[model samples]
Target: MRIQLDDLQGPEIHALLEEHMRGMHALSPPESVHALDLDGLRQPNVRFWTAWDGADLLGCGALKQLDAEHAEIKSMRTAEQHLRKGVARALLAHIVEQAQALGLRRLSLETGPVPGFAAAHRLYQAFGFQECGPFADYKLDPHSVFMTRLL
Candidate 1:
């Protein structure tokens, strides 16, 4: 798989994000949802990436800088066809490497507590992330499970 910086305007990225939103809507409640739309993903504080296998878009992920030393993971989704094929794992490892390269000492993320998100939660924990209370500007929310890893 090829991982690279992506322009949010790219059609592949747009398609993957649309798919992400649809999946979230189907699996989680509206009030608990915090996934970024195109406008939000294009914000100044965030950097997005798309993974491709030649002409096929495999997945996408992003990092949102929270402050000088912290960043939050965002919009990690693997195409349904690519699920269980290591796309999400590759994207996640790439994101963590980028965070460390940026001098971020910690990475945190919020994911749903729904069954659909179980694999993601486990994947993160396997990467050394631990349950944590919301940090930065995030508030406590019942449907959100917060995890963090010290880089």
Candidate 2:
């Protein structure tokens, strides 16, 4: 699988982002969720990517530059059909590598706060993320579990 920079207009990437937003909205209340939509993600600070197997998009992730030394993970999602196939793991590892390569000393993220997100939380923990305060432009929200890792 190849992970490459994504154009926000890419169909598969757009669909995956929409699916992630839908999943978040369905699982959590609107007021509690703060996922970036297409417009939000297309901002100058974010660098997005997608993992592809030939013509198929398996997963996607993004790193939003908070500053020269800090970044935030965003829009991480595995296709429903590709769940449990290590797609998300691969994408996540790619994100970490990119963060390190960019000389970002810290990486932060926001996820859900329920068992439904247990696997994701486990994945982040395994990658060295620890519970942390809200970073960048985020606010403290019980619905959002924030984490950070020093690279």
lDDT tens digits, residues 67-151, model 1? 9999999999999889999998999999999999999999999998888889999899989999999887778888889999999
Error of 2 at 40 (Å): 1.4
lDDT of 2 at 96: 95
- Predicted structure with the largest TM-score when compared to the true one: 1
Model 1 regions more than 4 Å off: none
In terms of lDDT, model 1 sits at 0.92
Q: Model 1 compared with the native: what TM-score? A: 0.96
Candidate that would win on lDDT: 1
- Tens digit of per-residue lDDT, candidate 2, span 1-151: 9989988887778888889989999878898777888988899999999988999989889999999999999989898988998888999999999999999999999998988789999999999999998888778888899999999
Question: Residue pairs in steric clash, candidate 2?
Answer: none
TM-score of 2: 0.96
> With candidate 1 superimposed using the best TM-score fit, by how many Å does residue 144's alpha carbon deviate from the native?
0.6
The Cα RMSD in angstroms, rounded to one decimal, for candidate 1 relative to the true structure is: 0.9
